[model samples]
Target: MNNDESQPENNKPKYKGKYRIDSTRLPAWSYASNAGYFITICTHGKKCFFGEVVQGEMQRSPIGVIAQKLWYEIPNNFSNCQLDSFCVMPNHIHGILVINQIREGDAMNIRIQEEDAMNRVSTSQRGDGQRGGVTGLFNPMLSKNSLSKIVRWYKGRCSFEINQIYEGFGWQQRFHDNIIRDEFALDQIRQYIINNPINWESDREHPPHPPL
Candidate 1:
């Protein structure tokens, strides 16, 4: 479904008190590492702003066309980011983003500097479950060339363009991302994205069917 839908509580990161922060990301793994990430970004409230699926094909609305164009321009914006299989759905987009070999000092590890009382507090102490927080603040700039930064850039660019024409256009605050660990998983995810439009009738993101 769309990324706007809430993930299970268990799947989300947890914050217990002030010092400990539990992350949903792979333990001891770095998000900026060279890897393939499957991403899903949804419209706010799961609105079908892009367009609709007709006869197993997506009819790209003006907004949808812009979305597709921007998706391709991602690599041009980020030198290390590469595009793979991607599809613009009615309410969400499914895409494979490959991060090529990163040079030294490109992807920085976000470290919490415990200087003040606020700094000592864990970023997720607020229980928001948002990833990549610096002293309880969501700062994408801290981790340069990271997956979250890349997605944030794409989303910001989309909003900037889409808002000019469609004021109501908005995206869910957080996106869904799954790290592709193996070739088989990557292939399956690619096939799933390719078939999303064909199976729209049964897609969870699809609006309720009209009465017969």
Candidate 2:
């Protein structure tokens, strides 16, 4: 046999396994900590259900508009997080999510503010199951600032709404993220999101697939 034929594939230095590799997260790094994250989420099978790019710009489809509206409202649902430099492509979305940790307010003051608002609201909506908007989430471990929780909520909410039109709309298995270490990296990511539409034709996510 030739020398190459006698070698083992597992002897390769970069080899992991036949099936999978390790996680992409940083060890001991808490996602909930105050930091900026660059995240990308794709549609199921890279289907072009969100919208199309025209003249170096993104023209929002009906479902894409819904995704945009809900994206800006993230802070309304979760007070500690804020969004920045977000864009919706034909089959994916790129955005920067910043976790504020929280706003300035003492514990007692915060409690008092919440109690005051509760009392001022209508008594008819005071109990659990009284409101249709409140639904239990499948992931109970979702932390306040977790990247997974934020992305999961966004994907779940978008799919729930978009399915009303497209029917059977779904998201890819998982998202990709990078931790922004400084202002330079933050600016770079922001510019990338801004230019995504302009660079759509050459994008790796181009030539989108059909329903999947």
Candidate 3:
């Protein structure tokens, strides 16, 4: 029998589940304009291989190395974007990404600051404003680029290269994102990312089964 045929095919996911949306075709309404977004990405079904705390320090694992490489490469890949804060845990990652640009009608009098840029738009406005501007808030006019597409590209590229390095590891079909509305929320999320490693043991997504 072929080596491929000898192994069980059940390990592969049968359905994309919630993660298979074609990010490039994400409705225009989902675009994240000149704003700050807090993003979390997990390994394929939250496989935890990045690291386990040993002696109170995060020792590098294959997944951890891949996450770190991707974290540093964010700025290089996305122009007008800066990585404010981030953390790579064994099974997942949390990051603060600020997309810098002046929105129409935004104050051009003042030089664009990262914080000011992020706060320029409101998350409530980014929703699908239907009930009194609830869903319509995420109107297509506000977004400059397709947030979903960018994330898809980033994750896809990362997965391809990481798999090359490690041979078979993979990423989940999609990632999770939340727009930061105010300075307070931004700060809170930043703190969460910074402290993620400290709270790893209790993470809900920590994979229970390991590859045999």
TM-score of each: 0.72, 0.69, 0.63
- Tell me the lDDT of model 1 at 151: 82
Model 1 TM-score is 0.72
Question: Tens digit of lDDT per residue, candidate 2, span 55-106?
Answer: 9989888988998888998888777788889999988887888976666753
> Best candidate, lDDT-wise?
1
Clash pairs detected, candidate 2: none
Give the poorly placed runs of model 2, Cα more than 4 Å off.
Answer: 1-24, 103-142, 208-212
What tens-digit string does per-residue lDDT give for candidate 3 at 1-212?
A: 11110111223211112111111222222444567776766777666767765543567687678778877886676664677888777776777777764445433422242244334335435554432142232333233334544566567777787778676677666566666779987777766666555655554554566522
Candidate number with the higher TM-score (2 or 3)? 2
Clashes of 2: 0
Mind giving the per-residue lDDT tens digits that candidate 1 earns over 1-212? 22221232253321111111112344234455678988878888888889888899998888989889999999887888899999998888988999874655444423222122244346455655544342233332334566777887788889899999989898988776777889987777777888888887777667773311
Mind sharing the TM-score for model 2? 0.69
RMSD of each: 8.6, 14.3, 11.9
Better of 1 and 2 by lDDT: 1
1 or 3, which is superior by lDDT? 1
The TM-score of candidate 3 is 0.63
Instruction: Output candidate 1 Cα RMSD.
Output: 8.6
